[model samples]
Target chain A: MGSLDTRRLIVCRHGERCDFCFSTHRFHWLDKAIDEAGRYQPFNLNLPRNLPKRRGGYDSFRHDTPLTEMGYLQAKLIGRAFRDREIKPHHVFVSPSLRCIQTAIGILKGMNENHTKLHIEPGLFEWMRFCRNVAPSWLTVDECLAAGYPVYQDYIPVVKETELNMNESLIDFYDRSHLVSKTLLSRYPTGNLLFVAHGATLDTCTRQLCGEAPRSNEEFFEIVQKTPYLSSIEARQTGAEQFEIIGTPVPPLAHSANAAYDSQYLTTPGYANNTDTL
Target chain B: MGSLDTRRLIVCRHGERCDFCFSTHRFHWLDKAIDEAGRYQPFNLNLPRNLPKRRGGYDSFRHDTPLTEMGYLQAKLIGRAFRDREIKPHHVFVSPSLRCIQTAIGILKGMNENHTKLHIEPGLFEWMRFCRNVAPSWLTVDECLAAGYPVYQDYIPVVKETELNMNESLIDFYDRSHLVSKTLLSRYPTGNLLFVAHGATLDTCTRQLCGEAPRSNEEFFEIVQKTPYLSSIEARQTGAEQFEIIGTPVPPLAHSANAAYDSQYLTTPGYANNTDTL
Candidate 1:
């Protein structure tokens, strides 16, 4: 058990995504999965078996995509790590992006905290510039609930979707994230909290809380690139409005990807090219 | 679903393993997870939540470690891939190793073939040299069933545990695998058969069926090292006694591992290292 005054927050990025990992300039999952008949055929193993319906059709996944199978496993591993380390969070907040929401689900399932519903905060979404100055149509709370996600239906979001500024600068994005972090801390007062959001959430939310100015646009981009999928950071509140970033409780998970095996290579030099005796 | 003469076999290696991935000469998971108190405490995220009881004790895991979480996911993904491609396996055979058995479980769950029980074959086990010229004590079918694995109760393996030759040469190992493959194909003459086993199983079992001699020991070792986890190969019987290796139904799954993030890196250099206002 933590002390009554202890306040800690851990922020994590979403897992591997299909669009970012598999999409090419000419080809995207939206084009491959949904055919002329409008039927979804999963041609790839990484693609999700079921995609949740959004108001703006499935093409909306161009900006907002679901996590790959490995991505979900990565998130679940972190959640299990948290459970192994006994880093219990009293409140869990998430970005409304499908990837983050799916990551939160994997994490909670890993932690065996199935009952803890995720508080989807629109303020936790990534920078507007990444979304091409347009907010992606995220799945609504009702849509998420209908899709069997464990969403906190009664709780209101810190930032409404309509309030999101598509033209917000990098500094403005940082300020928004800081405000949401601060507001959540104030509301919770004295318990561990978890945030499942984008790569920049680690810096955007915690930098100002630790009394540091936001990084320049160039530096922020560098930081985002360095943040790997399922990477996490921890911050502990020590005094009034003061928090210190600390080492994560778990070690980073690592594994090499398996390449496709071509059976042609398995052929011996002297063997009959065609083995069948017809 | 096919002509009565159709006979297809798919050979797959087990998923990622904890021992191979995490174990070192100085540090092994067996020592860390099990304490002097004889109680198991999973210190790492990749460690299994519960280990099945074996006569050789937990140390038995030194030779037969369970699959990592990623391993399970890999197997399940392959299963899902089979489902996606509509490649149904009428029968499944697994190596007696714990990793292979666990992988079989994940694959079956992914294929949604919960009713399909696994046939544990000692003959399907890896080369004796790899096990250091000693047959390791494996989890008995009863023990596996008690642990809730879907093992076929009535089926008897072609090779018994006591029949394993610890001093078998490389050629002998190939012959053993070939015998097992031949026996299985003869038993199930028409339906699609799946073998969930070791790396060399792909070559060992199918080499003779395809009318090829086994590779030299050096070549064999190289092949094993090159064979990645969850890699699979497919072979179809074209004649009464002839089989031809062909392309797998599903593409290989790929993803880079995420590196762990340290919170110390997030601190701005100019800011106070200590944020607390004391």
Candidate 2:
């Protein structure tokens, strides 16, 4: 058995999502891509090349969007960096969101670790306040398996999706995340644990595990807003049932956004005509 | 010889640039990443994994920066899309900018076209107004070759770097690009040609060939601003020397900007302490 001191936990945010980045007040790719005849066509390169079949149909993407191309790439790069640095996670747990599942897949592909399967933990999902007091219609374990994701077929989650407190306060959210973290850590008891979820998971899941107090709503929002996609935090086991928050194992990924190119600009008349050259 | 109807020309903008995306007025990665000892270390994932050596040393990145991680991926994806669609470019020409050269390399890699080499052309560069009346210290063809780029070392440029009109107006920019376009198409009249350069190259190089007038500064700027990274335009030969500007063969790439994550928020106090859960 590995020493308890070596046991570590990593919490990471999912990569860029299509809805938050591409959708406007009046239009969204999810709505525009699907034809009345049920044909799906992606209009932009940053959008997902394909989407997995969902129980709620394509409309479910409004609540649970997939990662953009760069989003997947960001997660994959982080995985490659971890592989190069020899930081291996023995067990992987991810939020039930499609973006989170895709991110976990990208990381595993990057690390070239085909053997490790992901545990789809609804307990690891983002704050319910952001979800508007309702559980996101996430894909089931069977659905995820059919989608070719390396999900553990038999691993049961500590906190089921239906049991999530959609009306939970900030304090309740912290307790729930802390409970999940503790349950998973205690259950495994050895090797490293990696969590691929939302921005707040980096804090909520490990904050109480490190014996830190829960943050207020304003504080929690501030942390979530500051956390960019694929940002991660690491925690090391310091004592019995205790962990200390360590710095990230890799440098945080950063890049400016790419704007959608408008074809109209090619012929849009602005001001004046061709002038003579010097 | 291929039919005149089958001959094609594609003009493309380079991928996301490191300097334009990551640098602020106060601090630039080129200066910050290099220590006083001249050891180069990338502080972020979006910055180039490694930089090619230059005659002006690491400081040269100020004028010629490499592509961000997503930038390279965007170009590669476009290449893959083109390859999938069987849109093969028999010859490729690239601007002297590091980003443009790197983009060409990415596209070639994606298309699995190892036999083709890039012809670095200074004439295809963006407007001199943006260059501030001075030539950017670009990597020599030999320097690029030494850096493992597949460059056509023996191909003499139609317009040398020193010949670029640093003080030229928008009309001059269009005319220069037009001359280069006409010269290249006339010289190699059989196969398709692909030019990877700046956002404006999609217009400046092909507009005149299509019998369109030079765009005014206002008009040119509008087009340039709307042209996202890896944006492309195609032109096909019509009669003898005449060509018609066709629309893009692939979907325009798009995504939102990624903000840099600050670690301070993790520990920074916001408001109040942990309250009892509901």
Candidate 3:
């Protein structure tokens, strides 16, 4: 094999705040609704509010938002996991989104690997959430019922509407997100590949790779079972033409009491149990 | 207009260097071929072949690859131009490509503009030129004939081959380049917009805005002529949702040639032209 041939694909979803700290913050209720409906049923629902008063609307402030405290720990765990396994990546592929970029930077920092080349691709951005300040609220119980119950089956449709209302869609996000991994795989085939992406993108990408039926965003998180973290799919390139998924592993973290303390500050609570105490 | 609307788009191409300087020096003959043909055509053609050697390649040496003396001068010119026009951009978009990035930094250095929010978007990258080490002399006249004539019509095919042979393509480049502008436009409708991009992307974008057919890579330089160092396109958002191209204007230099020389290096032809003179 050529010295430059890529050997392994190391995939990592970007850390957590990206999921919770959207522009409108109104999506918190929507996320809660989905979480309450259980992980199997998908349901579409409109956001109760219009655009947040942010600059980029929902997508604004992406560049300045840092990883939450939980996010930092998640990255550190992934870095340690790689170190424990003695894995060294030749190149790093990252989403330009602030959360993913920060996660990639943090993971590398934790591992003390400073010199790897990081290529930021926009295709890895998270699914778009349409936010309008004027979006009508579901004030009455009947209005809530008309809005439809949040079912796992309705997740895709709801996310699609959210994107459309916001002028950005999950399908488009998935399509573009896949391009990020595809570009990385095609360009740097045999290397430990790490993709710091949003939860929705990571969910969609993993399902596509794992060949599962479309999963709701909530169920997608269940596949990894960690909040504000990284998930890995170990794939071996058999030749220049093929890739074989060898294992999908979510590295275990050393539980600490502080984990719970950090979780309390997140915009969304109860997503994960934080047994760790300060 | 909304208080946050982007009133203008400031587009500028990267600075100058010889092909050898950009790692593209090996294709001097191809550049020469295009330039020769451009003289007879209505459009201008001034492609710089400043390709740098592969990073860490055996032949790579510690030669100074910093911006040239002309490049610095060009950057200052752009800065002064912005200042003179009293242009203040809310957002600055830059191509992640080295030359364009450096150019953006240089120009920003001279202006009073805030640099805290500059974004390096990879989507704004120029047309990709794959390196093929084969000598032009080795190819026969017949091979040149097989490659087709040096008209704008034939340029895209050859450029495509050059990129594909090296795993890059103009089509992908054009699409990606356009994505940067589109993304920025969606977010910043009425602020002053600054884009530091490649000559090719700027050219294609300029042509597209002017309602011309997509020009070939060689012809791109024609539509967007290069200045002594800097070239610019000024555009304004009009009619609520449309952008109207103003004009391509060159930035004025702050210091005259004599004053600039007096302020900096001791002027001499060889020394002034030497990139290492810095």
Candidate 4:
């Protein structure tokens, strides 16, 4: 009704991954709460953390984790859903992470809309980690192009390996993620858009577009913990300053994927399916 | 390990409600997207908005809306979870809204711990709304005490119906919620603490604790849309300047109920859920 300052931002969490994990990283305050509680042995969290990562536990690593067969299917499902609705995004922006690239490819194939180009936006990459060892290693533009996805030629890599500069806190991530909307709103004020990124991005963008308050670290942990692959939020502008949730249509991946389904996904580089794992 | 500045702000979203709605409030950009192709069609959102008491769709009002049976059970489950873990919150803070009051009661009863008191905090109330038509009608201290929950003796009411003073914008809410941590960190510096309030409180408190950046107007909508009832987040102080998510252990609400289940909740007190709607 008003001028076209309104838009839709369909934010997607990349499909499942071997390294993009929550199972083993299950949070335990007992280790950190000791300092925050300002008391010792106040209570025991008894977090069954290491148990999930031990001998019978899973061996998880960071970066370049490929999607399981299930992950590809999940992405494809989202793509197919888009096609069924005849909703073709004006522009699709993707995080350059391995999983995101794969998910984006799956979505394109499913949509079967060859017209819209994929823009490799590193700005939508995973939250900048303070822990140097766990920081993301994004795919280069050249590599992404070689992988055969149509990447925006002008896209520049925002994240750098040598730079340890980061927003180590969820607050920092919130700030960065919050900015993504400002940029998106300004760049494409009246078009339906899609963002394929990580759990944090999904949480931040979805929360932001829905007019919800920023999340606390505690809330964030829970949000990311259950962010199943393909989980998404649909935002359609109701007014210049208002938007509405069309829905969250993440078809269930597997009822027991978190604990039951753990198919081995490729972990190393130069693999056949580079789009789904890095 | 670190100094007293360390803290874990566990934030909780109040339970389900008939009014915490998303139906009918569906979204739209225009009626159609002409694209760079600029065409137009009347795309109706088909929202099933309630027709009651509407001059033209906005007869917004606010008061205490009690929790459904399921909501009560959900809160109780969270309390029971804390008790089972021997996790005792040294201090518990509650928003003055009725649902929050009810939820705080449920959690306390389930905790089965008698030492602490429920602080009826207005600072933790919903971001102040400037629209007089939608101002919150909080239960009087006398009314709350009569309801049988332990009301903080020193607690003072902050929001006034006659006064226009309030934090109505997301920026305002963010600033106020951030201050909540400053006050808590200053006063309770070292102890397990709990915050019980609405979806906005959950989002603001959690984001603030995790040290997230300020939110713009666009980011706020998506955040509020899918705030699941009984949803929660756990914060763990990793160091004075660092915190981690321990986990979100709120068991599924439908899983069970406590022996002390009370069905005749105060749902008809010239009140509806004041929160969410505003």
Best by DockQ: 2
Q: What TM-score does model 4 score on chain A?
A: 0.69
The whole-model lDDT of each prediction reads: 0.82, 0.84, 0.44, 0.55
lDDT of 2: 0.84
The local lDDT score (0 to 100) that residue A195 gets in candidate 2 is 96
Q: What is the C-alpha local distance difference test score of candidate 1? A: 0.82
- Weakest 10 consecutive residues of candidate 2 chain A by summed lDDT: A269-278
Q: What lDDT does candidate 2 reach at residue A171?
A: 91
Q: Measured with DockQ on alpha carbons, how good is candidate 4?
A: 0.01
The most accurate candidate by lDDT is 2
Candidate 2 on B180-213: residue-level lDDT in tens? 9999988887899999999899999988898889
Give stretches of model 2 more than 4 Å off.
A271-278, B271-278
lDDT of 4: 0.55
Clashes of each: 0, 2, 50, 31
**TM match of model 1 to true structure:** 0.82
Q: What does candidate 3's lDDT look like per residue over A63-153, in tens digits?
A: 3343543455457556755775676666665554555666776678767786654555445545445333333121122321233311122
The global Cα lDDT (0 to 1) of model 3 is: 0.44
Q: iRMS of candidate 3, one decimal? A: 29.3
Q: What is the DockQ of each candidate?
A: 0.34, 0.45, 0.01, 0.01
* Model 3 misplaced stretches (Cα beyond 4 Å): A1-278, B1-6, B18-65, B130-171, B209-212, B216-218, B224-228, B249-278
Report the C-alpha lDDT of model 4 over B192-249, residue by residue, as the tens digit.
7788886666557656555666655554543444344555666677666555555464
lDDT of 1 by residue, B152-221 (tens): 8888898988998888899999999999999988887768989999998988988988898889877787
Interface RMSD of each: 7.2, 6.6, 29.3, 20.3
- TM-score of predicted model 2? 0.93
Question: Sorted on DockQ, highest at the top, how do the candidates line up?
Answer: 2, 1, 4, 3
- Which of the two candidates, 1 or 2, achieves a greater DockQ against the reference? 2
